[model samples]
Target chain A: MSTSERLIESTRELLWERGYVGTSPKAILERAGAGQGSMYHHFRGKPDLALAAIRRTADEMWATAEAVLDGPGTPYERITAYLRREREALRGCPVGRLTMDPDVIADDALRAPVDETLDRLREHIAQIVEEGKEQGEFAPGLDGEEIAAAVVATVQGGYVLARAAGSPTAFDAAVRGLLALLAPPTR
Target chain B: MSTSERLIESTRELLWERGYVGTSPKAILERAGAGQGSMYHHFRGKPDLALAAIRRTADEMWATAEAVLDGPGTPYERITAYLRREREALRGCPVGRLTMDPDVIADDALRAPVDETLDRLREHIAQIVEEGKEQGEFAPGLDGEEIAAAVVATVQGGYVLARAAGSPTAFDAAVRGLLALLAPPTR
Candidate 1:
């Protein structure tokens, strides 16, 4: 990979591990095997480089979600696919994890991509719910936007529980419970 | 307050604002208005002081949750009261926030209090759900542990969404969405 590509990838990994505040330009350069001059030549500074990294990560996350949400299947099947998609549960969501960093959240440029990624994902999920409603797959009174919000929260929160317990059991339990709630009630 | 007490309080505030990795001993001492000699005399170092601060915060969080969970009311009422309780939504959950701090999670001493706090809180909520089930407030097939996990995740994840959006509206939406799901469905 080119120096710029390597730098951005290193920054993304560092951001996930050390967060924006804790990650230093020196560390990123070292991780990327690039010198100070090379880093500065490629980007304005740490913040500038971080913005690039954040946006890249955000796009990747959205693309992954889109694959599941826009997959060829019924709304229930697609939503379930999204929920059951393989994930590094303990590592947590890259975009969701960035929200915990005060430095990242404080910067409008850094925060925008993160916000848009989630907003778009939630909208996509809401649209699917809307589709489900149209097909009579859900109760007519169910609010698509509200259910979408809950779906996103459940996934994000599941990571918190999983990380805390040092096990994914809690995460699985939470997802199972949510799925049970979403299942069609038997007569 | 005594120097030790002041130091712990300052550490707590810094931890909440910047996290364990981002917070430094100098920052803690400065915030406490204590000198280097006094800080070192009171504690071994930042880790020692941080452990005390984390434990203190954990206790405070548990006490606050218990106040809402064990209050006089039906299970739903108590849970709703806890959810509706005023919070600095954008600032995030103090204990839950620690999970995102690599330094905090890497240290066994630092991580224990954070882990235990969340565990106890989930257990506390699960017990409430169990009671609600017995009282016929929740569906008979609902898993108390699972529902409890979902409730906790919603709050933690809600902070992520709120901070990303730079608005409390996302947080409110997440909470309302979860509460709607928890509401009993009429046949």
Candidate 2:
């Protein structure tokens, strides 16, 4: 890979592991095995590099979700697939983790992709939920937007529980509970 | 407050705002308005001081939740109360945010209260769910532990959404969605 590509990938890893405030340009250089001149030559500074990394992470997350959400299945079934998809629960969500960094959240430019990624994902889930509601899959009173919000929150919160307990059991249990709630009323 | 109290309080605030890795010894001392000698005089170092602060935060979070869970209300009512409680949603949960801090979670001593706080809260909520189940408030098939886990994850994850959007709309919507799911089976 080129020097710029190496720098972006290294920044993504550091940002995921240490957060924006904790990640330094020197560490990025060391991890990327690229010199300072290379980083500045390709990108303006740390913030500029970080934005690219974050957008890349956000885009990849969307692609992963899209593959499941838009793939073959009923709306509810697809949501289940999204939840049950294999993940490193302990490692946490790459894009979601960035939301916790004050430095990232405080800057509009840094935060845009992170915000848009979540908003778009939730909206996509909401659209599927709307389809389910129209098809009488979920109960009538449930709001598509609200239900989708819960679905997204469960995934994000599950990571927090998994990390705190050093296990995926809590995350699994939470997802199980959510799927149970979303079960078709024919039961 | 004593010098130790000031230091602990300052550390708690710093941990909440900046996270463990971002919080420095100098910043903690400055925030506490205490001298370097005062910090060393009371605790071994940053880790020791952070533990005390974390425990304190954990205890307070428990106390707040217990007030509603243990209050005079039906099980479902109590859960709703817990969900609807006033909060600075965009600032995020103090203990929950710490779980995202690698420096904190990696250190068993530092992570104990954070893990315990979430575990204990979920367990406590699970007990309430059990009571509601026994009272015939919820559906017969639901599991208390799993349901409680979802409830807890909603709050933790809600903060992520709120922070990402720089608004409380998503968090409020998430809690509202959860309450709808948890509504008594009579509906």
Candidate 3:
């Protein structure tokens, strides 16, 4: 990969592991095996680099989510598939973890990608649920937006519980519980 | 406040906002209104003081949760109360945030209170769900443990969503959605 690619990749990993405040330019250089001058030549600074990395993470997150949400299945089946999708529970979530970082959330430029990703994902899920209701797969009165939020919460919060216990068991349980509650299979 | 009390309180605040690696002895001392030597006099070091602060946070968390879980009400009501309980959503969950801190999760000493609190809380919620089942308030087939995990995840993940959007609206919606699904008002 080019110096630019390596830098962005390193920033993503550091940002995930250390967060915005804890990550440093020197650490990024060392991790990416690029010199200080190379960093400046490629990007303005750490914040610029972090934004690039975060966007990449966001793009990747949305890609995976859309694949499932927009996949072939009823709203209930697709939603369940999305939740049960294998995740790195111990690592928490790339986008969700950023919300915990004060530095990331404090800056609008840095936060835009993060916010957009979550907003879009939730909206996409909501649209799917609405489609389900139209198709008579879900109750007519079910609130699509509210259900969307619950589905997103289960996955994000499940990581927290799983990490605390040093296992993915809690995360899996949360998904199962939510699945049982979601319009269960009537087939 | 006593120097020890002041130090513990300051550590708690810093931990909530800054996390373990971001927190420093100097910051803790400055926030607590104590001198450097005073901090050393009260605790062995930053790690020791952090453990104390974490335990205190966990203690307070349990105190609030139990007040409702053990209060005079049905299981569904108590569970709903716990989810709908007012929170500093933008600031995020104090204990849950720690799980995202690499330094805290890396150390068993620092992680104990966090892990214990979440474990006990899930178990407590699970026990309440079991009661709901026995009381004929919920379907007997519901998995108490899974439901408890979902409840905890909704709160933790809800905070993530709220912070991401810079609004508590997402968090509130998630709770409302979960409530509508959980043992509906069938009197």
TM-score for each model: 0.96, 0.98, 0.98
Model 3 lDDT, residue B67, Cα: 92
Show where candidate 1 strays beyond 4 Å: none
Output the lDDT of residue B91, model 2: 87
lDDT of 1 by residue, B1-187 (tens): 9999999999999999888888989998889999999989999998999899999999999999999899988888899988889999988888988888888778888889988888898899989998988998888898888888888888888888888898888888878877877876642
True contacts kept of 1: 0.62
Better of 1 and 2 by lDDT: 2
Q: For residues B46-68, what per-residue lDDT tens digits would candidate 3 score against the true structure?
A: 99999999999999998899897
User: Which 10 residues in a row give candidate 1 chain A its minimum summed lDDT?
Assistant: A178-187
Task: Put the candidates in DockQ order, highest first.
Answer: 3, 2, 1
lDDT for each residue of candidate 3 in A1-187, tens digit (9 for 90 to 100): 9999999999999988878877999999999998999999988988899999999999999999999888888888899889989898999899889998888888999999989999999999999889999998887878999999999999999999999999999999999998888855375
Off by over 4 Å in 3: A185-187, B185-187
Q: Write the per-residue lDDT of candidate 2 for residues A1-187, one digit (tens) a residue.
A: 9889999999999988888988999999999999999999999999999999999999999999999999888889999999999989998999998888988988999999999999999999999998988888887888889988999999999999999999999999999988887888685
| Candidate 3, TM-score of its B chain | 0.97
**Can you write out model 1's per-residue Cα lDDT over A1-187, one digit (the tens) per residue?**
9999999999999998878988999999999999999999999999999999999999999999998889988887788889889888888888999898888887889999999999998889989988988987766777888888888988998988888878888788777777767765642
The DockQ of predicted model 2 stands at 0.84
TM-score (C-alpha, index-matched) for candidate 1:
0.96
